[model samples]
Target chain A: MKSRLRVLRAERGWSQADLAERIGVSRQAVNALETDKHDPSLGLAFRIAAVFDRAVEEIFDNPHRTEGPG
Target chain B: MNPFTTGPASREYQLATAGWFTLYGVILFTVAWAVDGRGLAAPWVYPAAVAPALPIAGFLWTVLRFMDRSDEYVRAVLGKTYVIAVHLTLLLCVAWGFLEVYAGFRHLALFWVFPVFWVAVAVTGRFIRTTR
Candidate 1:
Protein backbone atom coordinates (compact mmCIF):
# COMPACT_ATOMS: atom_id res chain seq x y z
CA MET A 1 0.00 0.00 0.00
CA LYS A 2 1.33 3.39 -0.98
CA SER A 3 1.61 5.90 1.83
CA ARG A 4 2.32 9.61 2.37
CA LEU A 5 4.33 8.80 5.50
CA ARG A 6 7.50 10.43 4.29
CA VAL A 7 5.69 13.61 3.31
CA LEU A 8 3.88 13.83 6.59
CA ARG A 9 7.08 13.06 8.46
CA ALA A 10 8.88 15.73 6.49
CA GLU A 11 6.19 18.25 7.36
CA ARG A 12 6.81 17.47 11.01
CA GLY A 13 10.59 17.79 10.56
CA TRP A 14 11.02 14.30 12.03
CA SER A 15 13.61 11.94 10.64
CA GLN A 16 12.70 8.32 9.93
CA ALA A 17 14.21 7.22 13.21
CA ASP A 18 12.35 9.93 15.11
CA LEU A 19 9.04 8.96 13.55
CA ALA A 20 9.75 5.32 14.15
CA GLU A 21 10.42 5.92 17.83
CA ARG A 22 7.18 7.87 18.18
CA ILE A 23 5.31 4.93 16.63
CA GLY A 24 7.29 2.30 18.52
CA VAL A 25 8.78 0.47 15.58
CA SER A 26 12.16 0.17 13.92
CA ARG A 27 13.29 2.69 11.32
CA GLN A 28 13.49 -0.18 8.83
CA ALA A 29 9.79 -0.87 9.28
CA VAL A 30 9.04 2.79 8.76
CA ASN A 31 11.21 2.75 5.67
CA ALA A 32 9.34 -0.28 4.40
CA LEU A 33 6.06 1.55 4.86
CA GLU A 34 7.36 4.67 3.17
CA THR A 35 8.74 2.72 0.22
CA ASP A 36 5.54 0.69 -0.22
CA LYS A 37 7.49 -2.52 0.31
CA HIS A 38 5.39 -3.53 3.30
CA ASP A 39 1.79 -2.89 4.14
CA PRO A 40 0.97 -1.84 7.63
CA SER A 41 -1.60 -3.74 9.64
CA LEU A 42 -4.74 -1.91 10.73
CA GLY A 43 -3.25 -1.30 14.15
CA LEU A 44 -0.04 0.13 12.74
CA ALA A 45 -1.92 2.32 10.32
CA PHE A 46 -3.94 3.68 13.18
CA ARG A 47 -0.77 4.24 15.19
CA ILE A 48 0.80 6.11 12.28
CA ALA A 49 -2.28 8.24 11.86
CA ALA A 50 -2.29 8.94 15.54
CA VAL A 51 1.31 10.06 15.43
CA PHE A 52 0.63 12.38 12.50
CA ASP A 53 -2.76 13.63 13.74
CA ARG A 54 -4.49 12.55 10.54
CA ALA A 55 -6.96 9.94 9.42
CA VAL A 56 -5.58 6.57 8.36
CA GLU A 57 -6.99 7.08 4.87
CA GLU A 58 -5.08 10.36 4.61
CA ILE A 59 -1.80 8.53 5.19
CA PHE A 60 -2.39 5.20 3.38
CA ASP A 61 -4.20 4.94 0.08
CA ASN A 62 -6.28 1.81 -0.03
CA PRO A 63 -4.93 -0.29 -2.88
CA HIS A 64 -8.33 -1.96 -3.16
CA ARG A 65 -10.24 1.26 -3.66
CA THR A 66 -12.25 1.27 -6.90
CA GLU A 67 -15.27 3.59 -6.51
CA GLY A 68 -14.15 5.44 -3.41
CA PRO A 69 -12.58 8.89 -3.52
CA GLY A 70 -8.83 8.88 -4.15
CA MET B 1 16.63 0.24 21.88
CA ASN B 2 17.11 -2.17 19.03
CA PRO B 3 13.83 -4.01 19.24
CA PHE B 4 14.78 -6.71 16.76
CA THR B 5 17.40 -8.35 18.98
CA THR B 6 18.53 -6.06 21.79
CA GLY B 7 16.52 -4.43 24.55
CA PRO B 8 15.87 -5.11 28.20
CA ALA B 9 13.23 -7.69 27.34
CA SER B 10 15.36 -9.07 24.56
CA ARG B 11 18.31 -9.39 26.90
CA GLU B 12 16.12 -11.21 29.39
CA TYR B 13 14.97 -13.53 26.64
CA GLN B 14 18.54 -14.32 25.54
CA LEU B 15 19.83 -14.84 29.05
CA ALA B 16 16.93 -17.13 29.92
CA THR B 17 17.33 -19.13 26.75
CA ALA B 18 21.05 -19.43 27.29
CA GLY B 19 20.54 -20.58 30.84
CA TRP B 20 18.00 -23.21 29.79
CA PHE B 21 20.23 -24.47 26.96
CA THR B 22 23.12 -24.73 29.39
CA LEU B 23 21.01 -26.87 31.68
CA TYR B 24 19.89 -28.98 28.73
CA GLY B 25 23.49 -29.61 27.64
CA VAL B 26 24.50 -30.48 31.17
CA ILE B 27 21.65 -32.95 31.57
CA LEU B 28 22.33 -34.57 28.20
CA PHE B 29 26.03 -34.99 28.89
CA THR B 30 25.50 -36.23 32.45
CA VAL B 31 23.03 -38.84 31.24
CA ALA B 32 25.40 -39.95 28.45
CA TRP B 33 28.28 -40.18 30.88
CA ALA B 34 26.22 -42.18 33.35
CA VAL B 35 25.10 -44.59 30.66
CA ASP B 36 28.54 -45.10 29.10
CA GLY B 37 29.54 -48.79 28.76
CA ARG B 38 26.14 -49.65 30.24
CA GLY B 39 23.51 -51.39 28.17
CA LEU B 40 20.26 -49.57 27.28
CA ALA B 41 18.40 -52.44 28.89
CA ALA B 42 18.62 -50.64 32.22
CA PRO B 43 15.31 -49.20 33.55
CA TRP B 44 16.84 -45.76 34.11
CA VAL B 45 18.18 -45.41 30.55
CA TYR B 46 14.90 -44.27 28.98
CA PRO B 47 14.09 -41.79 31.77
CA ALA B 48 17.60 -40.38 31.63
CA ALA B 49 17.32 -39.84 27.90
CA VAL B 50 13.98 -38.08 28.32
CA ALA B 51 15.20 -35.76 31.07
CA PRO B 52 16.74 -33.18 28.73
CA ALA B 53 13.32 -32.43 27.27
CA LEU B 54 12.44 -30.59 30.47
CA PRO B 55 14.98 -27.83 29.84
CA ILE B 56 14.12 -27.81 26.14
CA ALA B 57 10.48 -27.19 27.01
CA GLY B 58 11.58 -24.34 29.23
CA PHE B 59 13.59 -22.91 26.36
CA LEU B 60 10.56 -23.02 24.11
CA TRP B 61 8.53 -21.30 26.79
CA THR B 62 11.12 -18.56 27.00
CA VAL B 63 10.83 -18.03 23.23
CA LEU B 64 7.07 -17.78 23.51
CA ARG B 65 7.46 -15.22 26.27
CA PHE B 66 9.79 -13.17 24.11
CA MET B 67 7.25 -13.14 21.32
CA ASP B 68 4.57 -12.20 23.79
CA ARG B 69 6.51 -9.15 24.91
CA SER B 70 7.84 -7.90 21.57
CA ASP B 71 6.28 -4.99 19.73
CA GLU B 72 3.91 -5.86 16.90
CA TYR B 73 6.28 -5.26 14.00
CA VAL B 74 9.20 -6.99 15.66
CA ARG B 75 6.95 -9.96 16.42
CA ALA B 76 5.79 -10.00 12.82
CA VAL B 77 9.37 -10.05 11.54
CA LEU B 78 10.28 -12.87 13.92
CA GLY B 79 7.10 -14.80 13.12
CA LYS B 80 7.79 -14.73 9.39
CA THR B 81 11.41 -15.66 9.93
CA TYR B 82 10.42 -18.62 12.09
CA VAL B 83 7.86 -19.81 9.55
CA ILE B 84 10.44 -19.65 6.81
CA ALA B 85 12.92 -21.50 8.95
CA VAL B 86 10.42 -24.20 9.83
CA HIS B 87 9.50 -24.91 6.20
CA LEU B 88 13.11 -24.78 5.04
CA THR B 89 14.25 -27.08 7.83
CA LEU B 90 11.50 -29.58 7.07
CA LEU B 91 12.25 -29.55 3.35
CA LEU B 92 15.99 -30.04 3.79
CA CYS B 93 15.63 -32.69 6.47
CA VAL B 94 13.17 -34.65 4.38
CA ALA B 95 15.43 -34.48 1.33
CA TRP B 96 18.39 -35.58 3.43
CA GLY B 97 16.34 -38.47 4.84
CA PHE B 98 15.68 -39.76 1.34
CA LEU B 99 19.37 -39.51 0.48
CA GLU B 100 20.37 -41.22 3.72
CA VAL B 101 18.05 -44.12 3.03
CA TYR B 102 18.57 -44.56 -0.71
CA ALA B 103 22.07 -43.13 -1.32
CA GLY B 104 23.78 -44.42 1.85
CA PHE B 105 24.41 -40.99 3.34
CA ARG B 106 25.14 -40.69 7.05
CA HIS B 107 22.16 -40.06 9.31
CA LEU B 108 22.06 -36.81 11.24
CA ALA B 109 21.57 -36.69 14.97
CA LEU B 110 18.09 -35.64 16.17
CA PHE B 111 19.65 -33.04 18.48
CA TRP B 112 20.82 -31.03 15.43
CA VAL B 113 17.24 -30.09 14.48
CA PHE B 114 16.99 -26.77 16.36
CA PRO B 115 20.49 -25.72 15.36
CA VAL B 116 19.65 -26.44 11.71
CA PHE B 117 16.47 -24.37 12.00
CA TRP B 118 18.39 -21.41 13.49
CA VAL B 119 20.91 -21.60 10.67
CA ALA B 120 18.11 -21.54 8.13
CA VAL B 121 16.54 -18.54 9.86
CA ALA B 122 19.82 -16.64 9.76
CA VAL B 123 20.29 -17.37 6.07
CA THR B 124 16.73 -16.45 5.18
CA GLY B 125 16.86 -13.25 7.22
CA ARG B 126 20.07 -12.17 5.60
CA PHE B 127 18.67 -12.92 2.17
CA ILE B 128 15.61 -10.78 2.89
CA ARG B 129 17.61 -7.85 4.24
CA THR B 130 20.17 -7.87 1.48
CA THR B 131 17.54 -8.19 -1.23
CA ARG B 132 15.63 -5.31 0.33
Candidate 2:
Protein backbone atom coordinates (compact mmCIF):
# COMPACT_ATOMS: atom_id res chain seq x y z
CA MET A 1 0.00 0.00 0.00
CA LYS A 2 1.23 3.45 -0.96
CA SER A 3 0.00 6.58 0.73
CA ARG A 4 0.15 10.29 0.20
CA LEU A 5 0.87 10.95 3.86
CA ARG A 6 4.26 12.39 3.14
CA VAL A 7 2.89 14.71 0.50
CA LEU A 8 -0.03 15.70 2.68
CA ARG A 9 2.16 16.34 5.64
CA ALA A 10 4.61 18.26 3.54
CA GLU A 11 1.84 20.39 2.13
CA ARG A 12 0.85 21.30 5.66
CA GLY A 13 4.47 22.07 6.60
CA TRP A 14 4.35 19.40 9.30
CA SER A 15 7.38 17.35 10.28
CA GLN A 16 7.06 13.64 10.86
CA ALA A 17 7.35 14.18 14.58
CA ASP A 18 4.63 16.81 14.48
CA LEU A 19 2.34 14.50 12.56
CA ALA A 20 3.15 11.58 14.86
CA GLU A 21 2.50 13.65 17.96
CA ARG A 22 -0.82 14.79 16.54
CA ILE A 23 -1.70 11.21 15.65
CA GLY A 24 -0.55 9.74 18.96
CA VAL A 25 2.13 7.45 17.55
CA SER A 26 5.89 7.31 17.67
CA ARG A 27 7.77 9.36 15.10
CA GLN A 28 9.42 6.18 13.89
CA ALA A 29 6.04 4.80 12.97
CA VAL A 30 5.32 7.91 10.95
CA ASN A 31 8.67 7.62 9.23
CA ALA A 32 7.99 3.98 8.44
CA LEU A 33 4.64 4.86 6.93
CA GLU A 34 6.10 7.66 4.79
CA THR A 35 8.87 5.39 3.52
CA ASP A 36 6.44 2.60 2.63
CA LYS A 37 8.26 0.34 5.05
CA HIS A 38 5.04 -0.19 6.98
CA ASP A 39 1.43 -0.28 6.01
CA PRO A 40 -1.03 1.40 8.29
CA SER A 41 -3.95 -0.67 9.47
CA LEU A 42 -7.51 0.51 8.78
CA GLY A 43 -7.81 2.26 12.09
CA LEU A 44 -4.51 4.02 11.60
CA ALA A 45 -5.45 4.96 8.03
CA PHE A 46 -8.70 6.45 9.26
CA ARG A 47 -6.86 8.43 11.87
CA ILE A 48 -4.39 9.69 9.34
CA ALA A 49 -7.14 10.67 6.99
CA ALA A 50 -8.93 12.41 9.81
CA VAL A 51 -5.80 14.35 10.64
CA PHE A 52 -5.57 15.56 7.05
CA ASP A 53 -9.30 16.13 6.72
CA ARG A 54 -9.23 14.05 3.56
CA ALA A 55 -10.93 10.85 2.55
CA VAL A 56 -8.97 7.73 3.36
CA GLU A 57 -8.97 6.72 -0.30
CA GLU A 58 -7.34 10.04 -1.18
CA ILE A 59 -4.52 9.35 1.21
CA PHE A 60 -4.18 5.60 0.64
CA ASP A 61 -4.45 3.59 -2.54
CA ASN A 62 -3.73 -0.05 -3.21
CA PRO A 63 -2.09 0.02 -6.60
CA HIS A 64 -0.94 -3.58 -6.87
CA ARG A 65 -4.36 -5.03 -6.16
CA THR A 66 -6.42 -4.66 -9.34
CA GLU A 67 -10.08 -5.34 -10.00
CA GLY A 68 -10.99 -8.38 -12.09
CA PRO A 69 -11.48 -7.90 -15.81
CA GLY A 70 -15.07 -7.45 -16.87
CA MET B 1 -0.60 8.36 37.15
CA ASN B 2 -1.47 6.36 34.04
CA PRO B 3 1.34 5.98 31.55
CA PHE B 4 -0.81 4.48 28.84
CA THR B 5 -3.14 7.44 28.60
CA THR B 6 -0.11 9.65 28.09
CA GLY B 7 2.15 7.65 25.73
CA PRO B 8 3.13 4.00 25.64
CA ALA B 9 6.57 4.20 24.08
CA SER B 10 7.47 7.27 26.07
CA ARG B 11 6.70 5.50 29.32
CA GLU B 12 8.46 2.31 28.22
CA TYR B 13 11.49 4.30 27.16
CA GLN B 14 11.50 6.31 30.36
CA LEU B 15 11.30 3.25 32.59
CA ALA B 16 13.90 1.37 30.58
CA THR B 17 16.18 4.39 30.72
CA ALA B 18 15.70 4.72 34.49
CA GLY B 19 16.47 1.02 34.87
CA TRP B 20 20.04 1.82 33.92
CA PHE B 21 20.34 3.91 37.09
CA THR B 22 19.41 0.89 39.17
CA LEU B 23 21.83 -1.21 37.17
CA TYR B 24 24.54 1.29 37.98
CA GLY B 25 23.77 1.04 41.67
CA VAL B 26 23.87 -2.74 41.52
CA ILE B 27 27.20 -2.69 39.69
CA LEU B 28 28.69 -0.20 42.13
CA PHE B 29 27.50 -2.21 45.13
CA THR B 30 28.77 -5.48 43.69
CA VAL B 31 32.16 -4.00 42.93
CA ALA B 32 32.49 -2.44 46.37
CA TRP B 33 31.54 -5.66 48.11
CA ALA B 34 33.78 -7.82 45.91
CA VAL B 35 36.81 -5.54 46.31
CA ASP B 36 36.46 -4.92 50.05
CA GLY B 37 35.43 -8.46 51.13
CA ARG B 38 33.40 -6.63 53.74
CA GLY B 39 29.96 -7.68 52.62
CA LEU B 40 28.66 -8.18 56.14
CA ALA B 41 30.63 -5.40 57.72
CA ALA B 42 29.65 -2.80 55.13
CA PRO B 43 26.71 -0.94 56.61
CA TRP B 44 25.56 0.03 53.13
CA VAL B 45 25.40 -3.56 51.85
CA TYR B 46 21.83 -4.11 52.98
CA PRO B 47 20.56 -0.86 51.49
CA ALA B 48 22.62 -1.36 48.35
CA ALA B 49 21.23 -4.83 47.83
CA VAL B 50 17.66 -3.60 48.16
CA ALA B 51 17.75 -0.02 46.90
CA PRO B 52 17.88 -0.93 43.22
CA ALA B 53 14.71 -2.96 43.65
CA LEU B 54 12.70 0.20 44.34
CA PRO B 55 13.53 1.71 40.94
CA ILE B 56 13.06 -1.71 39.38
CA ALA B 57 9.59 -1.92 40.88
CA GLY B 58 8.80 1.53 39.53
CA PHE B 59 10.04 0.46 36.12
CA LEU B 60 7.85 -2.63 36.26
CA TRP B 61 4.82 -0.61 37.30
CA THR B 62 5.31 1.81 34.40
CA VAL B 63 5.69 -1.05 31.95
CA LEU B 64 2.55 -2.75 33.23
CA ARG B 65 0.58 0.47 33.19
CA PHE B 66 1.35 0.92 29.48
CA MET B 67 1.19 -2.77 28.58
CA ASP B 68 -2.44 -2.97 29.59
CA ARG B 69 -3.25 -0.86 26.51
CA SER B 70 -1.54 -3.15 24.02
CA ASP B 71 -3.29 -3.70 20.73
CA GLU B 72 -5.06 -6.96 19.87
CA TYR B 73 -2.04 -8.27 17.97
CA VAL B 74 0.17 -7.48 20.94
CA ARG B 75 -2.27 -9.09 23.35
CA ALA B 76 -2.50 -12.20 21.20
CA VAL B 77 1.27 -12.52 20.91
CA LEU B 78 1.70 -12.03 24.65
CA GLY B 79 -1.13 -14.39 25.41
CA LYS B 80 0.46 -17.11 23.28
CA THR B 81 3.84 -16.70 24.94
CA TYR B 82 2.24 -16.68 28.37
CA VAL B 83 0.40 -19.88 27.51
CA ILE B 84 3.69 -21.51 26.69
CA ALA B 85 5.18 -20.26 29.94
CA VAL B 86 2.22 -21.54 31.89
CA HIS B 87 2.58 -24.97 30.30
CA LEU B 88 6.29 -25.01 31.01
CA THR B 89 5.70 -24.01 34.61
CA LEU B 90 3.01 -26.66 34.98
CA LEU B 91 5.31 -29.31 33.57
CA LEU B 92 8.07 -28.36 35.97
CA CYS B 93 5.73 -28.30 38.91
CA VAL B 94 4.27 -31.68 38.00
CA ALA B 95 7.71 -33.15 37.59
CA TRP B 96 8.71 -31.92 41.02
CA GLY B 97 5.49 -33.26 42.50
CA PHE B 98 6.13 -36.66 40.95
CA LEU B 99 9.69 -36.67 42.21
CA GLU B 100 8.55 -35.78 45.71
CA VAL B 101 5.82 -38.41 45.61
CA TYR B 102 7.76 -41.37 44.19
CA ALA B 103 11.46 -40.63 44.29
CA GLY B 104 11.37 -39.28 47.85
CA PHE B 105 13.01 -36.00 46.89
CA ARG B 106 12.40 -33.64 49.79
CA HIS B 107 11.97 -30.43 47.86
CA LEU B 108 12.70 -28.72 44.55
CA ALA B 109 13.85 -25.15 44.17
CA LEU B 110 10.80 -22.94 43.64
CA PHE B 111 12.61 -19.89 42.31
CA TRP B 112 12.37 -20.84 38.62
CA VAL B 113 8.74 -19.79 38.37
CA PHE B 114 9.61 -16.08 38.50
CA PRO B 115 12.07 -16.40 35.61
CA VAL B 116 9.59 -18.42 33.60
CA PHE B 117 6.96 -15.71 33.87
CA TRP B 118 9.44 -12.90 33.27
CA VAL B 119 10.90 -14.52 30.16
CA ALA B 120 7.45 -15.07 28.72
CA VAL B 121 6.45 -11.42 29.09
CA ALA B 122 9.80 -10.08 27.93
CA VAL B 123 9.98 -12.27 24.85
CA THR B 124 6.37 -11.59 23.95
CA GLY B 125 6.77 -7.82 24.20
CA ARG B 126 9.90 -7.91 22.03
CA PHE B 127 8.26 -10.20 19.51
CA ILE B 128 5.16 -8.09 19.05
CA ARG B 129 7.08 -4.83 18.62
CA THR B 130 9.58 -6.28 16.15
CA THR B 131 7.39 -8.67 14.22
CA ARG B 132 6.78 -7.73 10.57
| Highest-scoring model, DockQ | 1
State the TM-score of candidate 2 restricted to chain B. Answer: 0.44
Candidate 2: misplaced stretches above 4 Å? A63-65, A68-70, B1-12, B15-59, B66-131
What would the DockQ be for model 2?
0.07
Candidate lDDT scores, in order, read: 0.77, 0.63
| Candidate 2 vs. true structure, TM-score | 0.46
Kindly report which residue stretches of model 1 are placed more than 4 angstroms away from their true locations once superposed. Answer: A26-28, A67-70, B1-3, B37-41, B129-132
TM-score per model over all chains? 0.82, 0.46
- Model 1: which docking level applies? acceptable
Per-residue lDDT of model 1, residues B1-132, tens digit only: 234455556789879977997998899888888788555546888898889778868977887898797666556666777788889999999999999999999999877787788689768766453111
CA displacement after TM-score superposition, residue B32 of candidate 1 (Å):
1.8
Candidate 2, B1-132: lDDT as tens digits? 121223465556556746755675676577567547754546756665555345546545655654465542333334555566667668777887899999998885564555555565555444433214
lDDT string for model 1 (A2-66, tens) is: 78999999998999889988998777677777876567888989999998898898888877777
